[model samples]
Target: MSRIAVVTLVLHFYMAITVSTFANQTGRPNVLVIMVDDLGYGDLASFGAKDMRTPHIDRLMSEGMRFNEFYANCCVCSPTRAALLSGRYPEMVGIPGVVRTQPESNYGYLTPDSVMLPELFQKAGYHTTLIGKWHLGLAKPNRPNQRGFDEFLGFLGDMMDDYWTHLRLGNNYMRRNEEVIDPEGHATDLFTQWSIQSLEKREADGKPFFQYLAYNAPHFPIQPPEDWHERVKAREKNADPARVKNIAFVEHLDDGIGQVLSALDKLGLSENTIVVFTSDNGGKMKYGASNGALRSDKTHVYEGGIKVPTCVRWPGKIRAGQETSFTALTMDILPTLGDLCGVPLETEIEGRSFKPVLLEGKQAAFTEPVFHMWLQNGTKEAMREGDWKLVRDNPGDPFELYNLKNDPFEKVDLANEQPERLERMVRVLMVHMEKAQKIPWKRPEAQANVNH
Candidate 1:
């Protein structure tokens, strides 16, 4: 061929290559968000827990990055989940805590105004499905299906009955969209199966999908499959009976997670998918759950209450065999997924995207301060700003400040020694709370304190 003809061919090939690369980079990826109930930070082997063998979870960490200073936003289920779904503070959604009651009510529940991450995906032409616990709200206008998920099959309550068959009755039963019915097998296994079915359907539909597999395993009234119980019993080999049972239950949950993960691998969706594994909060330490030397347990503002295990895997996008100490919150998941899936969040989100750090394995910065409050009616008990955390028991008690950097366990009280620093942090917390529209705990004396 002549030189002019060869040059023309080379130019055409170069243009095609550029266009293909741009399409690949801008293409929306399928998202698989898996959240475990009451899973402690130190439960997984990748998180430095030598007790349990979490091969599936560890594989996710090995292929992605493990977040060491990640927090769950709330110490409980419903609130944290609300924050996770909306990318906003749970308190803003009026679900300051878990939603509990026989007949669900709209009082203090997540409202329709709050846009969920799944809804964003749905609008972006992605099929959204949730197969697991959705404790954010149970009343009308707050259900998962109403919030943007095309399909939802799970319990609306925080806890479930037995693993076999269906657990609770009359509003407690497993729900698909709005109908209540009994699902066979364990809740964990059922969730896994439903997730696989959704994946298969999405594959056939020729559309990207978002699957939220929230497992309510290893929570309370711990029970496990017979095989898992036998295996854990053999491993313990004469250890405490209760502890053995608890381990068995955890292992059983792990097995269920493994099934779903294996299905993803089998479906050949692993490379084009982004999977994030985390927990709602710390473990129930009373039941022999390890928090990896963190002081205190759930229900407190300490590290154990908020900080939890976190891992993310996005094949080809995120580097494998990476670990990061970059602080992250459960609320960040929505925005991060939004960035990865090309779904721009509509709600004004408090959490920022960590896409830069996840894809490049580089250190990132968080501009917004993370806040926490545990109140019964209208009370603020705990709040954290940056590395400084303040804990208060009642309105009368003095604020206890600690530098999480120096005292992550919150063992030492530095309020007296670092009065100025404490004051500054208190001001930061007060400003945040005010801007967030959080009502202070109702106390006659507290009103006076706030005015002063």
Candidate 2:
């Protein structure tokens, strides 16, 4: 958010266009995407947080390009995950909101026809697996195995009430494939070890792999290992209770990440792997989370709600310590990976690959800026056209506009002054909203249960 950081980001991308891109390069790198739940933009040490240490994740930002203006497709989990995998907005795929375990609270379902990232990689002869958090569906058609992931070894619910129990409302959601078996460790630790084991298997099989290691951590229940919790309290001494728990939980997550990264190095897979770390959305402000100077937190389309810390690390492909202010969405990951791995998608998607930006330093210029709308029961909507953004909190609410370039925190309301810009973004948003009518989000049988 600093003037210098902005300046450096622009210069970095503008000069990158002259460099060669990695999309056309040989040797497809193993893709390992690490997505954490509800991590705020300022949660990482590299993002200028002085209160905690996240050296493992911070190393990723330093080791590769850190996207300063990265935005998650939605302010919540399931939708963003849908967008990230499908390379399209969540609503476009019938996921305008969270995919809860209970039918009544569930807001979205992965469209049966949509092509996902792992499918593209699978077509390219890559072994794909998802080791944590598969909230896209709780049953048959939408399971990870059905959705192109070769294997699924994690919980299949929204958020676990107890990290240890891995349950939601007393139902066991843990699974290793179709079998319901209870895992014996903290969720974060189990996921990390599973990822390490996956890497080891890749080395043994000698196959290119795509592992989506999503972690449900530091989100709620705010559970950290007792040792980690005590250590934070010991070190920070009388820190705010909420801050202490959050810091400890996030730090523990970071340590797990370190273990995963270390596995890559030990397996000699570091150089040949493209590792990306990002969150589903920004942190919850009221929950001892900080989004730095950004406006609001999760569930709203404000910067704090949608903006996230994103970094990509591929040893020889992407240069170290590079940063870009590319206004990219979680949806962009699909097309970007497809192009990078020489695997083109057959299904249509709204995402644009910033491969040129990543490889050659070209700036991501959009004719129509990407969107950030979360209509989970008609709660929030946001659209971006360049630096201009439009947001509204609830259904039938008056829209507010802000020029994010000048006011990163969204402090100024330009809705009255920039009528033309607001109208333009609204028109774009409406067009996308209209398209959502084409898909049925839930089963007809569940219709009676879902009020929204």
C-alpha root-mean-square deviation, each candidate: 6.3, 9.1
Scored by CA lDDT, what does every candidate get?
0.77, 0.87
Q: Give candidate 1's TM-score.
A: 0.88
| Clashing residue pairs for model 2 | 16-360, 16-361, 17-360, 17-361
For model 2, residues 1-452, the per-residue Cα lDDT tens digits are 99999999998887664332442255577899999999989888999888889999999999989999898999999999999899988888878888886777778877778888888899899999999998888888888888889988898888999999888999998888888998788999999999898899999987899999999997898999999999999998977999888999999999999999999999978988888889999999777888998988998888999999998888877889899987788998888888887786898889988888888777647666677777566658888887788888778899999888899999999999988878878898888777776677875567656655
Worst lDDT 10-window in candidate 2: 17-26
Candidate 2: TM-score? 0.92
Candidate with top lDDT is 2
Error of 2 at 201 (Å): 0.5
Please report how far candidate 2 places residue 214 from its true position, in Å: 0.1
Tens-digit per-residue lDDT, 1-452, candidate 1: 99999999999999988975764677578889999988777777767776577787788888888888888887777778888898988877666766765423222466546788888999999999999898776566778888889999888776776767555543455899899877778787788888888888887776788999998887766777788888878887876776677777777777777888788788877777899999888888887676788866666667787788888998778898888888888888999888877787776878888888898877556755578765454445566666777876445578898888888888899899989987877787777667555532122233476689
lDDT of 1 at 178: 91
